[model samples]
Target: MAGATLLPLATAGATAQGTATLTDIAGRQVRARLPARRIVLGDGPLAYVVALLRPDDPFTPIVGWGDNFRSADLGGYLAYRQRFPTIDRIPTFRGSNVGAIDIELAISLEPDVVVLNLSSRAAAESSGLVARLARAGVPLAYVDFRTRMFENTRRSIEIMGEVLGEPVRAQSFLQFRQRQIDRVMAPLRDLGHRPSVMVERAAGLYDDCCLSYGDGNFGELVRAAGGDNLGSHWLHGTFGTLHSEQVIAADPEVILVTGADWRLYSPTGDWVNLGPGADPSEGHARLRRLMQRPAYRTLAAVRRGRVHAIWHPFYDNPYYFVALQKVAKWLHPERFATLDPDATFRELHARFLPVAYQPGYWLSLNTDS
Candidate 1:
């Protein structure tokens, strides 16, 4: 990390009154003062707060964080870097949500509040990271964008808003999120029968068969979008590996593969380059290749040209409403024939994000090459 000025959390916390007690997603009580000026975000997913609350200047209050975005979502990092060229100055800890966290180093940064994901709370506590932070007098705020998101995402957003001194903005964003969701779900309420959709998490990020979300993240998104997630029936946890044989057995009606331009991480990998300023022709080519896999050829989705690829990062962020629209569009094209997910995404960027809008976030096999 590049241009940063470290300050003591004690001084920042002293500026406010008594500590505010809030219940985290893990149902644990977190005590922290209001308007935390110095923050250390646990994983890259918490970056959603920065984009939503402080989009104009996200790096200002951020003292340190897990540098997952730079590695997992390079396009998003590049966009932030373009605007705040000095973001690299902020100190960062190694690892994402599931990785081993450096608690001692995080406390050394002296952040008044440390925001983590509820899904990773067990790992953090098992490693004694939480106790160390608590001993150092650094309050931890646990938020979640996955795992029962429909019921908890708003609470997570509101908690961040309250801690960051933007309660109004947080509530407004929740309203906006609900509206986006209603736009897709309202019409599908009276409809019966949902397409069995399979979510391929981080497609091509590995060398083996495939990984996917079971009951969380993209699995939840597919359900919300009026589709039956195959993972929900077979797997028991948030994520798990699905063998090619398992996929062939399920024969999902819609195969939705999550991908991104991870060429920097895997130059010759089969991942699709789908993000801002992405090329449709290139995405089509990559997705077509995935469809040609032996097991995929035997799947119903591929035979009917219903296979699709979408942005991978949507699995970790609060921008899932956008994913919902995209999923709905793919699961039932007839009902959503006039729906424009790209237009909705552009509206979100224009209203909330500092960056300009771009396409290629998602596409279907049937789309013109």
Candidate 2:
């Protein structure tokens, strides 16, 4: 695909027309031509870009993207490929996770705008990626959905829309997302007690004891879902590991494990294979194994069958309302007795996703739990 034809957003020696200056998530002034016809999106933020810009034709402006879509979430990749067969025709650059980006290959694609996650800004700057891209005359836009989801996710989407010339559609998506969140939060506004929840971030992904989010991402999601996150109180930043004794000491009421089919990364890994089209039996079996871990086996939450598993990638994308709703239902079942997160997810797909909604994003031990 290296020889694939490039979009004519600009000629070799001339600047594109109708350039605009905007502030990116990194507080940097980025001057780029408006209505970017060629775009290079980071893998983690690719789902949001597609959903917001062209839910029906996501490959339209994508000239290059990281390989996480295939390596991290095979179920999601298959769904998109089924809808848009030509998706594979687009060029793929080296992923941003393991190593430095292939600057030469990215420049060869000639993308008008490159979208990256704000979490990687420090690495981009320290590695001189910013200077190199500037010299190459390629514009970069930083967006975030993980850190400070409430504050910065919308701004990132707005920035993307402004650059892509889809401000109206972007606003529409934002409104839809807010409504979803409100539906879950408004009803529980008056609840006096919050469930003490422990979120195990990406269990078995690294063969470690316990990893979790602290005061951000899943931690914030727990709060938004009317639950108290033990990680936020113990850890200092967004992500950290806790000793097994500490988790047992906290004795959270709900133990939510974030997992995915990480076989590509760790072939024999113990992480849960829970995503689109996953079988409940398989998911439950994996959850059972996770519960057997020494750190979890003796915990009250595990013994009482309050343990649950959710998709891991929800932390990376903007459309996290589904996770929030599910978490709310699990943490406060009586309060949100009538809430249906599965139906809400299907509704979201009907309104925005190009592909049909496939079940199995999350699973719990027993329905009555």
Candidate 3:
């Protein structure tokens, strides 16, 4: 909130001309053309937020975007494509990271504004893409939903709303997001116990032992859901790896592995492919296989059937509040017995998304719960 500000228009004439001075989440002041007619997304998953702001035509303003979405959330991409086939026509760069962006192609698109994630600020500046875009008379804005999720999610949504000229819609979505999160947090104090949780980041996506969240992203979500995050005690950053031995030593009460439809990224890997329309039986079998890893085979969580898998994309998107509700229920079943994450997601799709809802975002080893 500190750096996200929309300055008053210079005059009615400028307002009529469709331009406004605004500050991005990175504290950079950019003068973006109002309701950006031509917008390039630095990360493709950003479309998830944009769709919430412009449910009718999320891709109309997007002339180009990064390629991460297709590979990272193939199920989600396919869902949108099924509804809006024209999405395939949008130009996409090689990678989601700023380093992999084709700067010349982005500038050649003649975009009114280029929106990148806050994590890309350093790369954008160091690589001189920011300066180059500035010289091209294009504005570059940064929005973050990953690195510092809770601190910047609202501000990022506000910035996107201003960029899209849908301030009212953005506020409505934000209020809805808050109400959902409050469902989990407001009743947390009344709960008697906080389970020790280890969130395996992209579990089985790689052949390595483990990757995990430390103090941000899903790590923050775990704490909000009334669980003590084990990774935070060892790793200092948002993401890092934990030795299999460390995982065994921690012996967490709950083991939540973040997974997705990673077949595109890891064709033969053992990742739990959990996403829109994913097969729950297949996902459950894969999750059980992951538990067989040396790091988890003897854990109390696995033995007690407290192991679960959740969609990995929630760590980076605005829909994380839904993940929070689901996790709260998993950690404290009796206390959050009636809280329904599936219904919450269904409402989100019905209210804001252009596509219909699908129910393959999560899976659990203990089906009885």
Candidate 4:
């Protein structure tokens, strides 16, 4: 289609004009002038998005995280940060309650636009958070990341950049991220090896549960890392428990445990004693010891020292680049010996992340005293 043409007006005190248009998902052509600064991010990837944008984008004058403290994914993020320094510290961004945001708070912020993560429309409608924000004349745009598709990781970063007027930065970041993932996955493509793996979550208290990842998430990470997931076919949530029988039946080629106690489990409750936390060999020994337990001893991975602990930082946040690097290298030593993933992770965490990277994190398949 030809571009829309503009006609000059004869009226006095008139400014020059150009035709500009944008079409929303509903096919509605929104013909309007450009937006001004002052934006509010409803919840979800807002902080991450804000961080990716160059420091000078005035558009996101004010950002909000919304009431997402209840989400399981968010919980995973919090858990890691609470225990490990490598997981980037989550920045503070305000929002309304799960039911509705406090209007007065948002009004004081006075944003021009609002972006939302409408994963559960029901949650939004029930609380009226979206409706009230809309009533305030804040335009809301929803972008899905958690579920709509796994690829939305890059998409979310791009959308945040678009709104913040830092498309170049976002593009560069994405390219860097993709290349890192490719490097991690490339070595595994040709190898006919798969480590039957299991991921367990910290249930706050009580015994930990067996968490499984499917084709969508870190399971993809595991596949790229060159290991078969034992609990994967059993069909579990991203953070869920599996029957002991289920774990034994799969007979994993490798077991990757995640918990604050992982590299450093103890009868007493202290985490620092675990390996240097950055030393892969120390962590490796820790995992090796855990595999020797009577029940785990039957597993082939335990018998052959195939288990290792990849410190569970970078579970979320932009630090995903670091997590993938460590996980891929941990899974495929022969293929990625030159990668030096830990050093790369340390640097990325030091540069892009808000927190400092700690050492002796990723461990072997054994337990340490």
Candidate 5:
């Protein structure tokens, strides 16, 4: 919003033979040859959506990608690598963000199109990389799974599907996604009590008391699951920090912490390692230790053991509907007693992913509850 001015969809038109003009989530028109053979991922996690669209071989079209995936979600990375050993051979950039990308190297890959996160548009434009890529005839597309997630996820998936020549697969995944979402939202339409909730973004990854979302990402999931996101009242942007005192004052009814295997990023950090094939016993122990922090130790949520830790990557992926369903059940167990987020995730893997599904994505302090 601060840098490049995106053109409206109305201004975009058809392209010539062997090419298609697409309106990315950022409202920018990108003209790339159909079924891009060589793609560069500005953010590695985007491979999650790519996997959904190209179940047989998600990494085939990708020539290069960012390095965040290995460190951000190590378990998932390992799982995929196990199934596709060639993943390690793919060229990886140093940073996941657009600004940190080596534009010259990305262009050198001769990618048919480069997929970047919508949140990086300002940096991409400010650095003149967008214009340079245009000059090099490299189509650049924007997709969002983090900032403005709910509003842009569907369009972003559709854009990728078109780029990858898997529109039907994309539609199927979208329908599945919608069904999962409706499974949680439809019953909450006449909700009685919206639990006060706080989702600590990257909870134990940092030493800070609280880092959270506001009206977006996990915060949006909380609301969709029928909970009041306390961070929305303070932080104006999609992400920001909340003071410990403010958190104490809020006294949320439920506390949700986002976490992942951070050994690569923070070798000695106090974070919950939760992801594919993660150890629930160890994850539960970490969650218990994290709740001991002053900011949470005194909260009613902690006292009543209504605190839970969910995979941090869900805040930045299309699989968020699974998190939404899990959160819904946590917020209103009685209403969603039959809901099984784990089964839904398993089905997602069996139907669309190349890797097998593993159990340790979410853990609650009070498993019985």
Candidate 6:
């Protein structure tokens, strides 16, 4: 057989576009040559990368979601269902990791390529996933975007697209995201409305807001969404557990919570239970109740009814295009028309994403405000 085709890979680190050249979690050199058609996604972080690459495909192109309940982004996606209809039409997904991938099942499915995130790669490698997948005739590609940076995630998607023979769609999304981003961030018309913001994931422990982004992460989303995430003020590695008093003193006009633990699961109109542990909207409801309590009532978000539960990953993923629109409408109701982030998100989910039914996901707690 002819040797696999090779490209210069312009980047100093990229050995080839389709080769396993990148450092796998186990520190082994995993390289690919040109492209891979069959793919597997083992974790939620990869889901963000995939969802960003495309938004409304009828089925999850790759396979597996590591139990959607553990994912922080599902709540936001489910919340967004109300604003978009196409998302609801897509089909559900089912698959497992390489180690757990029923060899017979995967072989029956017949895929040339597969993917797993950096964090989970070590586990996959420790389990001898490489050899296992190879024996099954499936090539594995490992990637990570936990840092939550859009550029890196975009590059990751472009890499995936090239291997999957969908680079054009990936490029289209990259450009589409850039255009929307440029339009939203042109310049804040309401200079005075720049609200100091605080975002937290309500994990039951009020002090555990450490899930918050300090910098170079979802904090950037707050900026793009038209507010200042005070957490960005802290060093990237330093996340503060501010007291209720601190928040009151800061008096941020807005509070954005990662509502992933809420009861809402699917992104298709009105809230539906993602079943038992998969709910993220419940967490948001709880946070709202906390904000309205006596001690916290002094805070601005609750007082002014500016509290919002958001799918924060969009802040750093291709999904951020929808994130920006949501923030624009949330931050400046009078200055801007509702962007219908659900629509944009649905389109992205349908066009570039292989997953079906990701529309009508965003739910508002303080719509009257």
In angstroms, what RMSD does candidate 4 have relative to the true structure?
A: 10.0
Residues 224-313 of candidate 2 have per-residue lDDT tens digits of: 999999999888999998888889888889999987767677787878787778777877887888888878898888878898999888
Q: What's every prediction's RMSD, in angstroms?
A: 4.8, 5.3, 5.3, 10.0, 6.9, 9.2
The deviation in Å at residue 328 for candidate 3 is 0.6
> What tens-digit string does per-residue lDDT give for candidate 6 at 20-88?
444433344555544443454555345555443333431234443344323344544453343343444
As a whole number from 0 to 100, the lDDT of residue 157 in candidate 2 is 84
| lDDT by residue for model 4 (1-369), tens | 011221111121232333334333223243322232555556643454554353222113444445343132343334334434332422233432334555556656666555655453456567676677667655555554443233566766665554554556667667767877787767766787565676543312134335445553556566656766554575555444576667777776666665343322334321222212344553454445555544366877777766555434334345465566766666676777888766765554444443344555555554431
Worst 10 residues of 1 by lDDT: 1-10
Q: What does candidate 5's lDDT look like per residue over 215-235, in tens digits? A: 988888898899999999998
C-alpha positional error of residue 84 in candidate 4 after TM-score superposition, expressed in Å:
19
lDDT of 1 by residue, 235-310 (tens): 8998998888888888889999988767667888888877777788888888888877765877878888988889
The order by descending lDDT is: 3, 5, 1, 2, 6, 4
TM-score per model over all chains:
0.92, 0.92, 0.94, 0.65, 0.94, 0.64
Pick the lDDT winner.
Answer: 3
Which segments of candidate 2 are over 4 A away from where they belong?
1-17
Clashes of each: 3, 0, 0, 31, 0, 48
Off by over 4 Å in 5: 1-17
